[model samples]
Target: MASVYHINKGINRPIVFKGFVAQYIAYLAVGLVLLLIGFAALYVSGLSLFIVLPIILGLGAGLLLVVQRLSKRFGQHGLSKYLARRKVPAFLRFSSRRLFTSLSRGGIIQ
Candidate 1:
């Protein structure tokens, strides 16, 4: 009889790509798209490769480093939580009295 082995991956495991987790991949994708657009714009504007390449390479390297750092520092969901934290205060600061009030005496004024 062959031994039975069970493999278990917990729910909500963060997807990883070459050491980058889920949201980091999204950040990198957007960064790369912007980088490509910038490169294309530079090339279209008749900029020499000598000038354009270095700038693109530098920016791309910086972007990768930043994304990697953010991924490491924030684990999987911390970055999003950090981003949402700012908006949360404003969202929670709602007044119920102001929300259901009538602006004018008339029902509808055009």
Candidate 2:
């Protein structure tokens, strides 16, 4: 049962994301991909808006939650843990900048 803080602190206890700006870029990349994939999946699968809608909305919500958690407060508040428990679609990736950003306020993005 690894916690977000536990994972953020490297095996050697090194702090991740040492800067905030880098993290912002990382988050932006991930968010964009998710949005794109959701739209793509909808067309590819030929699913109705009702079905595709949840996937798009859920993925976006997850991205928003992570950003909100890290930016609103630079501390461990279990947001990452919540995300980790859920399944992020394969189309999206949780990047390193995103990982570090969520862990601390030391992100590259302002």
Best by TM-score: 1
TM-scores of all candidate predictions against the true structure: 0.68, 0.40
Error of 1 at 18 (Å): 1.3
Candidate 2 has its poorest 10 consecutive residues by lDDT at: 13-22
User: Can you write out model 2's per-residue Cα lDDT over 28-105, one digit (the tens) per residue?
Assistant: 578879798868977687888878778787878887777756744543434455577676666856556676665577
lDDT measured at residue 59 in model 2 versus the true structure, 0 to 100? 77
Q: Which stretches of candidate 1 lie over 4 Å from their true place?
A: 1-11, 87-110
Alpha carbon lDDT of residue 36, candidate 2? 88
Across 3-109, the per-residue lDDT of candidate 1 in tens digits comes to 99988776668789999998789989999999999999999999999999999999999999999999899988898788899776554455565443544544445
Candidate 1 deviation (Cα RMSD): 6.6
